[model samples]
Target: MADHRRPPPDILVIGAGLAGIACALDLSRAGLSVELLESSDGVGGRMRTDRKDGFLLDRGFQVFNTAYPQVKRRVSLRDLCLRPFTPGLLARTSTRLVRIADPIRRPGDAASLMPGRVLSARDLAALAALTTRDVLLPASILKRLPDRSTAAALTRAGISLSAAEELLRPFLSGVFLEDELETSARFFHMVWRSMARGNLCLPAAGIGAVPEQLAAGLPDGTLRLEAPVVTVTDSGVLLQDGSERPASTIVVATDGPTAACLLPGLTVPDGRTVTTYYHAADTSPLAEPTLVVDSSRAVLNTCVLTEVAPSYAPPGTALVSTSVLNDDRPGGEAVVRRRLAELYGTDTSAWTLIGAYIVEDALPAMVPPWPVSRTTRFAPDRYVCGDHRATGSVQGALASGTRAAREVLADLARQ
Candidate 1:
């Protein structure tokens, strides 16, 4: 059972998530014998999708930004058949629903973005200035400018506290899975730049399709699912079934916590939690594929998923997805329903609750002074990489994986 008769693989990647898949692909591309092991039944750690009653429920509310350089390099957007959300979002204020469309993209809605109760002239100018700077300047310039909490950066940019609380906070809280806006300003600006340059989209299949595509490109027998690794040593890894598989190199490409578990003394940042609730309705609430946020902060954000991707639901049915920052307290769904009704201006008494997914480690908490990218070289033969080592985004995960492969290749060349 030790498989001692066979030669060891050149590289062993413990995890088949995006990072591991990317790493294994690159390593194999360099003609190295690589083996990727995953404990789960399938890949796509947090990006899995499930089919329930003819509805496709993504493990969490996730979107793909078309502008990420790694994504453009690795993923086939045209093949994914991406469906874009409306260019802007709607915020439900106390008196009325406010629409802030991208005037440059949607000139027709430029009038709708005029100064209003929620966004004053000062707020408008500040927002415009911030957008222009983020969009026009190189990311290196922004990362080097200064680091602070997002709240302070908003104030520094001249965004009014009221405007931030009403619009930016509610919208970004869902994105970062934090309410206090304590995330790093460097991360916020990078996200802002991506948003300005890209369109947020969902694949026609589901978010899981992204990983499935990456895994599909791997060499045969390079990936092994359901192979749980219990221990990792300098020489090889021990499997849960008491089998030992040796390798010349090992990369801990799992999530932050799992990687820490396998590699003792590894330090990982705190993580953020989020829960997404899916509800099925007979009729669609919003005709357009736009996101709706409650200024009251009752729920982070909600959208009609069926509007964006019809394949997510069966014929004649509408699927709505709502997300909360953390594991909602007991009886929170009722409150969310009431808030959704208010935001959509419709009755939800008859809507059917499909599923609620709680992701305890939705993303790594990116506080100030956090390195935008961390070195993946854990040791001469051991390496670690994931979103935790970089910013929390698809771009981060893939870039970390690519970086890990490059390091591994360099080390092997020396050997």
Candidate 2:
């Protein structure tokens, strides 16, 4: 028989996603007995990977920015074996495909930008100024700027309406998973700054490798998978199987909806949905790892993943990933494949449909007046942390976890 009077762990973090893993690691490193529980069979809640017919298909199209401060602090870059995408976008117009490369990252490609091709000279200058201001200035200043819709910010920054519709709208729609571009201007600036300062890449294995890497660094016996936590009480968590695990502290690190279900009265913000379709072909359509956006707003974005990392697909075959804002249509995959054919100017009918994943709660919507950071200390010894509590990004999740850990550490010291 087990003894119920046994002392509980110092901290119990629910959800083995990046947030929970980060918090557990921080507390454990400080000589505290930490127990991390995950409901799923494995780690990485949304950042999951699936294998189909010798192809690596990520749950959704996700990219890692090397400039995230929390990522650099927690995970080692070289270990993931990242492959970077070209620092520009190829916009598919009705007539032809236009390539726009960043002058800072691809200096040689910048020379191909003829005046009035994508943007007029004045609009290009305005874009350069916006990039310089966001990338060069400290983040503190960008955060202090008034919060507004990203569309409004572009207008205020002198980006012409045509440029906004042609260049920024389709590209950013994929980033935010919305066509309105109503995300917070501050959040947009931070994302742009991160992109400007870092390489956009994917792990050789998959996006799931990120959380797996974080979980690997934890102390032995610190993490437990397949532990579905149903309720989060003051003392600790109640497992679905009627097992009670007590702890001195608790942190709900699950997604917004799951976190809200566990903790009553917690408000779960509305989330954005996205769908990704994977296709395999005999030959590569685009020979570069450049993201292609439909200027006509037909599809979100498409990229040949094999161009970035040949390991993503089997030898002699190319893997392409196409993402569209989730509409919950009955035959969305067929529509996506047809659009791919039009975008790549190739016959996608022969391309094998590898997989289609529709993530309902892809990310929390970050409209104007969204908080970049939120209080993790919900109650004295109780807390909550996820991308929902802050900006909806990997950086947000890791940062919120780090903040929760600090809060727990400080509260424990006071006791």
Best by TM-score: 1
lDDT of 1 by residue, 4-83 (tens): 74568988999988889999999999999998999999998888889998999999899989999899999989989999
Worst 10 residues of 2 by lDDT: 1-10
| Each candidate structure's count of clashing pairs | 0, 0
In lDDT terms, which candidate is top? 1
What is the clash tally of candidate 1? 0
Instruction: List the global CA lDDT of all models.
Output: 0.90, 0.88
- 1-415, model 2: which lDDT tens digit per residue? 1126445677889999888988998999999998889988899889878877788889999998899999889888999999999999899865778898987778999875767866799898898899889989999888778999999999999999888988899899999989989999999999999988899999999888999999998999888889899888766788887878988689999999999898888887899999888889999999999999987766899999999988889999999999989847768888888888888889988998888888988999998887898889886688999999988889999999999999899988898
